[model samples]
Target chain A: MVTEQQDYAYNSKIEGEVVVSKADAVINWVRSHSVWPMPMGLACCAIELMGVGASKFDIARFGMEVMRFSPRQSDCMIVAGTVTYKMAQAVRRVYDQMAEPKWVVAMGACASTGGMYRSYATLQGVDRILPVDIYVSGCPPRPEALLDGMMRLQDKIKNEKSLYQMKKGREDPDHLPTGPR
Target chain B: MNFEEIFSELKRKEAKDCDSFICEGKDLVNTLEALKAKGYEMLIDLTAIDHGVEASPRFSTIYHLLSLGEKNYLRISVDCEAREEPVVPSVVEVFPAAEWHEREAFDMFGIKFENHPDMRRILMWDEYEHFPLRKDFPLAGIESEYPEQDVVERTDLKVKAAPMAGGPFVADTAGPMSQTEPMAKDQSWTESKPKKEA
Candidate 1:
C-alpha cells in the first residue's frame, strides 16, 4: 500500500513536482472553486437568484450554492436588485462587513445601473455604493445568466494575485483594491 | 347603519356620491372619530394629491374609509392650505393603520400630520430632504451636495420623443401645413370619377 506522500510524489512525477508548484495557484484554485455567496435579494432580480439556487439551475454544480445571509460568513455577495438611495448605506455596510478577499456580483440591470428607475429614490448603480467584480445584464437576468456571472467571478478570483501577497504578509488584505475600475 | 343615517348623524353635506364629503380641515379628526364610531372601522387608504403650483388650496389629503359590516365606503377630502408648511390633524387615534399611510402621504406630498406620534420619512431615507411627489421637486432627483455625491447627471441620458403627435391613437393635426378644413365634396369617398382609358 503506497503512503499518501508517496502517492503525491508519484502523481507529481507525471506532471511537475508538487512542492515546486505555485502556492498562489493552488490556493486560488481552491478558493475560486468554493466561493460561498451571500444572497442579497433586494427586489425582482432576487427571484431569479433564487431560481439559480433551486434545482433547475443548480448553482451548487459550481460549488456556490452555500447561500449565506450573514455578510461575515459569505465570500461573495450577489446584489440582486435595485439598490435604492434608501438602501445604499446598508449595502455599503454589508460590503464593509464581508471578510477580506470578497467579491461582489451586481446581478441585473437595476443592480448594475438602476435599470428604468432613474428617479429620486433609486440609486443609479450599486457600483456607486459597493465595489462590483461582475455585472450581469438583463432586467432581472435569467438563472443561466446569473450562473454565468458567478463563473466569471470565479475566473476573476482565480486570476487575483493579491491573495498570495496577503498570505505572504507582503500586502494588506484590508487595503485590497475595493474601488471601481 | 346606512350612509344616509351616518351622513345625517355626522351632519356632513352629502356629495354627488352620497358617501364622500369635503370635510373642513379643522374638523377632520372629529369627523374621522364620528365615522369610526359609526362602524367605518377600516381606513382603507390615505393619500394626497398635489394640484399644480398655481392651484389654490394646493393640496388635498384624501382618506378612503370602509365599513366592513355595512358594506359601504366613504371618501373624505380634506383641503390643506398651500403654505411653507401644510398641517392636517392626524387620525391615527381613530384608525391605527393610518400611521403608515399618513407617513407615506407626508413623505410624498409634504403634508404635515400634526400630533403624529412618530412622524418621519417612511419611504425615503432619514436624510432625504425633498418630498418627491411634490410638483416642484425634480422628477429625476436633485444633485447631491454631500461629500460623496451620489447623483451625477449623465450627459448621455436622452429622453426619446413621442412616436406620434398627441399619441399613437390620436390623428396628427399639429403638423406644419396640415389641412384643417373639411374635405371638398369631390374628395368624398362616395363620389366616383370616370376612369381614363389606359
Candidate 2:
C-alpha cells in the first residue's frame, strides 16, 4: 500500500527539489506561492485590484490569480478601496471569518488612510479594524503596485518561523494582540 | 402639458430658471399628481438644499421631473420648515420612486416623510445617531465608540495636517499671463474674434 508521504516523496524526487532542499522550506515555498486572495473590493481601488488579475499584469505569474470571494477558501484578503464606517463591521466580519495564517493587504491610499475623503462617512483606515500585513499606497494604486504588494506578502510568508509557531499563535490568544496593533 | 399649462393649473411661482416651478409643501403632492397626469413619468432626481440655520423654511426638497413622451423637463421645489422634528408630505403616493429619495432626505436632513412605507435610514447605519449632512452636524463627524477601538482616537494621530496659510495653488508672484497689462492685450483678441459656427 503506497502511503501519502511516500507518494509525495516519490513525486518530489521525480520533480527534483532544485532550491527547496528541506521539507520545511518546500512547505513554506508552496504556501508562499499558492496564496489564494479574497477580493474585498469596496470602491474605486477595486478597479486596479481587478486589473492586477487581468492578462497584461497577470497575477498568475506569482501563482496568486485564484481570486476567491469567500473568506473560507482564501489565505489573503486584498482590501481594495475606501472602507466606509458603515462597511467597517462587514470588513471585520470577513477578516474574522478568514482561515488562520491569513494575511491582509490594504490596497490603496483609501484603504490605507481613507485617501482624500476626510469626511464623516469614510473609515480613516482599514488597519483600525484588521491587522494589515501590507499597505500599497496610491489614490488608487496601479496594477504593478498591487503586484508588488503581493510579492511583499509572499516574502513575509516565506520568512515565517514555522508551521508550529503559526498554529501556536492562532491557538494562543495571548501570543497575538487581540485588536488592531 | 407644457410648462405654461402646468404653471396656470398649479398656480405655482415660475422659478428663475425656465421649465421650473416652486411649489408650496401643501401643493407638492397635488402638483406632482397634475404633472404625472400630463405624462411626466420619470422622477429624474430628488435632492434637498440646506438653507442655513437661521433661514425660515430651512429645507427645500428639489424634485426634477421628466416627460419622456414629450421630451420635456421640469423642476419643482417644496419648502419644509426646520423644526425639532420637521414633517413633509411624501410624494410616494404619486411616484413610487420617491420612496428611497425620501428615505435619503430623511437620513441626511432629519426631514420626516409622513406615510413613507419604510422610514429608515438609507445611507447611514441605523445605530448612527446624527444626520451627517445637516448644517448643525459637525463636518468632522460626531464622536462614536466602536466595539473594538475608539475610531476617533485611533485616527486622530494619523490625520494629516492641512497645508500652511497659502496652499500649493496660491502663486507667490504673478506670472506675465496673470498680469493685468498683458491680459488687456490678449482679451481684445479673444473677444473680437468671431464666434465659431457650430
Pick by DockQ: which candidate is best?
2
lDDT, candidate 1, A1-181, per-residue tens: 9756534335655776646667678878888889999888999999998899999999989998899999999989899998876676677768778987789999998899766665667767787666788999887898989898889888888887854568754544445655443
What lDDT does each candidate get?
A: 0.75, 0.76
How would you encode candidate 2's per-residue C-alpha lDDT over B98-118 as one tens digit per residue? 999999999998889888899
Return the clash pairs for model 1, or none. none
Candidate 1 lDDT over B1-198, as tens digits, reads 555465543345557763777777888888788888878889989999888788888998999999888898888888887564789999988888999999998888888999898899898866667788988875545655322232222112222111111111222355553453222323222113432335
Superposed model 1: Cα runs more than 4 Å off: A1-20, A162-164, A167-174, B1-18, B146-198
TM-score of chain A of each: 0.85, 0.83
> What is candidate 1's TM-score against the reference?
0.78
Q: Tell me which residue pairs clash in candidate 2.
A: none
Q: Write the per-residue lDDT of candidate 2 for residues A79-164, one digit (tens) a residue.
A: 99998777887887787788776889999988997666556677777887788999998768889899999999989988876566
Q: Which ten residues in a row have the lowest lDDT in candidate 1 chain B?
A: B159-168
